[model samples]
Target chain A: MKELTIGIDIGGTNTKYGIVDRDGNVVFQGSISTAEYEEFRDYFNGLAIALRKATESIPFAHKIIGVGVGAANGNYYKGTIERATNLKWKGIIPLADMFKEEFGIPAIITNDANAAAVGEMVYGAAKGMKDFVVITLGTGLGSGFVCNGILLNGKHGIAGEVGHTSVNPAGRFCNCGKRGCLETYVSATGIKRTVYKLLADHLEPSELRGISFDNLTTKMITESAVRGDVVALAAFEYTGRILGMKLAETVVHTDPEAIFLFGGLSLAGDLIFKPTIKHMEANLMPLFRGKVKVLPSGLQNQAAPIIGASSLVWNYLDNNKTQLQEEVY
Target chain B: MKELTIGIDIGGTNTKYGIVDRDGNVVFQGSISTAEYEEFRDYFNGLAIALRKATESIPFAHKIIGVGVGAANGNYYKGTIERATNLKWKGIIPLADMFKEEFGIPAIITNDANAAAVGEMVYGAAKGMKDFVVITLGTGLGSGFVCNGILLNGKHGIAGEVGHTSVNPAGRFCNCGKRGCLETYVSATGIKRTVYKLLADHLEPSELRGISFDNLTTKMITESAVRGDVVALAAFEYTGRILGMKLAETVVHTDPEAIFLFGGLSLAGDLIFKPTIKHMEANLMPLFRGKVKVLPSGLQNQAAPIIGASSLVWNYLDNNKTQLQEEVY
Candidate 1:
């Protein structure tokens, strides 16, 4: 029988899952509305149903050996989601335990960014690379660091919170009650924030001036930038400049060979890539200048999260081979 | 027969060396003036003679297994010192190869800070910890990062250059032509600079005002602070505040369990430690708050560099056990 794993990505709005084989092929997939289930029990029940339906439909149902979950604030060490602000659950939810009980398989959990980093390592751009960083640029910036070929799950399994690292102590205010966080100036919302600031600061005429903050999106800005809109181009440049400086600072901590960009904003392609690379090189210490590569995630956009989630199982098994073998027998 | 290793620490002014046993005990020690040799060949010859003389006097000379070197700008991978500004040599000096050729033993090299980190891991405070950072606060700031119990040597073998990381983009001018680097605000010279700035900014009664910038030292500032001089107190407070903030930012990157402070400035003790810990906790993200400890290095002042250098050989042997075993046989 072909071995497979069930990968689940739990987001605020939707929960995505798929039956993925060892080769990263998605045999079957499904989704459920996450916000509809206000209670943790209801969410778990819904997840169980979705997972079963996806797996049962596949021809190789018994081949599924394990389950892996990727979620916001997921703790790999504890297998719990601790006070995730976006979720309706108020306290720690033992999601991994629920999955293990429901599926009768080894289950593992980690934060989405770490899952993404594992995905890159197991099946994407960071293949065979021991030291690298993965930055997920969505509504907020998320990061996962791989050092010496292991995920840097520091003392508390929250090591790669690069987005929260302050770039300017007195700069922009962040949702996390801190000022000058890297995320406030580098995410998709960050780009939108930059566009609004640019529109307010400079009177330069451009297509982005009329869009209000609530209606504006990074995608629209990218389209405008492609069309040669001055304000949109400037927004990307500013965002990239801050990101580059932050990455340069990160480089001194753990000299990553490459920093891979993942998630929605990365789709902007060269609009974001060009300026980020330029500033990263400019801000780098002389020894690291032109040495580190800024690249895009190798996984497809929609499937990247699921793939990342799936990789957690393989990683867990690899690290716990002796215990896993005993349990299997 | 007991096993021993020769540890060499090459600084701008003096080169310190010692023969150390497996238990971190120094059997014999000596020093040579580095400035006396302008030519690399002359320096190597002098170093060979010094090593011979030091080992010949020791009772168990045949028991020495290997040699380790710690120097400014030392590259672990290349075993060379590249363009060290303080040294007379202008280009890459193959120091490790020279030691290997002269002594016919396994030799290794790494920067002093990295050596110090390994020393802490093998024989100091970080004995059981898998993740920690060692900050050496001397004339300049030097950092060694240990993640998952391995020293973080990036792709170029020059990771953990935390001193160069910018805290404030426009804060202070650094010797490396960068503005607002952490070293510019946190090192021995950094405190001295802070004292001068404080003198110019405040009209408070301070004995420091009488001293020129070149004459003022961190030691003198500490002495003045001990005497309840307001300016000196404020300088320490300011320096601690900036260091705390930078460390908090560093926490989000690798999430070290504890940050160990070593070198000259660390002698100020609670004068620097108290404020730094307070601000580090205050600036930390809620998840990391009260989680990471700010502590002092375990090694004594005079022996830290030599011990750190010695650790390089042990680390090298551990990592290259198969090759080392083959060579030994």
Candidate 2:
């Protein structure tokens, strides 16, 4: 019989689940409205029923052995989701235990960025690498660090929140109740703000000049920059410079071999990477100069999160089990 | 037979060695002037002869099975010391191999701070912690990180160089050819520089007014602060604030549980810790607020480095051997 794992990627509005084999392929995939459910348990119960029907519909002999979840504020150590700002669930939800109860199979849960890191290590550009960082630039920035080949959950399982790390600490207001967070300047929303700021600063005409902030999306900025819109181009340059500077500071922490940029903003390609790499190199400590590659995600954007969730299940079940070194001499 | 490990700490001016048991007790100890020898090979040869004589004088029956050296620029993977500016040695020296040839035993080497971190895990304040960071505040700042209960030897073995991380690209000149390195504001030399700068900026009469930069020391500053000197107090506040700010930034990278302060500048007690902890907590991201502790090394100042070196041997041999997780999902 074929062994299959369920990979669930939970977002603020949508929740996607996939039945995947060990090779990161999604055999069957479906989505549900996450924001509609008043409670997460209700959502999970409905999701379990839908998943079972989908599994039965599959035309192959397979046994679902484990489940993996990638969600906001998902804590690997506690298997709980605690106070995720974007999620409808307000308090700590025992996510992994819910999976176990609903599916009668072992489950592992980690924040989305961590799942992405494991996915990158398992199936993306970071394959075969032991030390690297994965940065997700979507609505807000999120990060996961694989140091010495282990995804860092840290002491509290909130280790890789690079987006919340402050660049100025007093500059920009963040939803996390902090100021000058790197995400405020380098994420998709961050770039849009930059574009608007640039538009106000310079009088040069561009495609973005008359667009309002609510209507002007990151896609418009990318398109405008590609069309050689000076304001849009400067916005990307500024965003990359901030991102690169922060990454240089971050390098001293784990000394990652490579950093992978994923999700929405990274789709801009060289518009983001060139300035980020240049500024990162310029700000880097002398030792890390000419080392540490900043690369785009290996997998295409559309199926990446589901692939990452699937990879997480496979990774937790069969790969990277660390023997706890508890013996103190 | 009683097994003993040789723990050697190499400094610019002196080299300290101890014959230590697995319990971290020094059975025998000796020192040699490191600056006296022009060639590193001749120095090692002479030191070996001296160590042999010292070993023969020991009253107990002990077999030296392994050696551990904590030095500047020591690389755990390569087993070499590469371009240690402070040492008389000018280039890469096969330090571990040198020990092996001289003693006919296995040898391990790592930078001094990493040794301290391992030492802290094995014998000091950070015992039982899976993730922690150790900062050494000596002539220049240095750091070692223990992540997932293993000494982080990153991809290149130079992972924990928190000292070289910059706060501002144009703020301070560092010996590492980078401006605004953390060490320039937190080490023993760093605080001294701060004290002098404070004196230059202030007009108030103080005990530190006429002291030449050459004669000024961190010890004098500490004493002045204790004596209620405003200038010295302000200098410490400034230094601690900078250290704490950088540490807040550093925390996102590794998410350590506790931060252990070792070496000269740490001896200032609350003069540094109070402000450092205060600022660190203040600047910390909301998730890590009041969680990470800034604590002094549990081992006393005089014996800590040697003990850390000895602990490195025991920790490396008897504990914390990581099975490389090379399997990709």
The lDDT leader among the candidates is: 1
Tens digit of per-residue lDDT, candidate 1, span B39-144: 9899889988999999887785357788888777788889899887568888888887887788778778888889999999888999999999999887778899
Question: Which window of ten consecutive residues has the lowest lDDT sum in model 1 chain A?
Answer: A320-329
Alpha-carbon shift of residue A32 in model 1 (angstroms)? 1.5
Across A1-329, the per-residue lDDT of candidate 1 in tens digits comes to 67788888888888899888787887788889989987889778877777777777877435787878888788888889987755789788887777767766777888889999999999899999999999999878889999989988887777888999987778898877788889999998899989888988998998987888889888899999999999999998898889988899999888899999998789999988998999888887776788899999998578888889998888777888787556544
Per model, the share of native interface contacts recovered reads 0.76, 0.73
Question: Which parts of model 1 are misplaced by more than 4 Å?
Answer: none
**Lowest-lDDT window of 10 residues in candidate 2 chain A?**
A320-329
CAPRI accuracy category, model 1:
medium
Chain B TM-score list for all models: 0.95, 0.94
lDDT of 2 at B259: 93
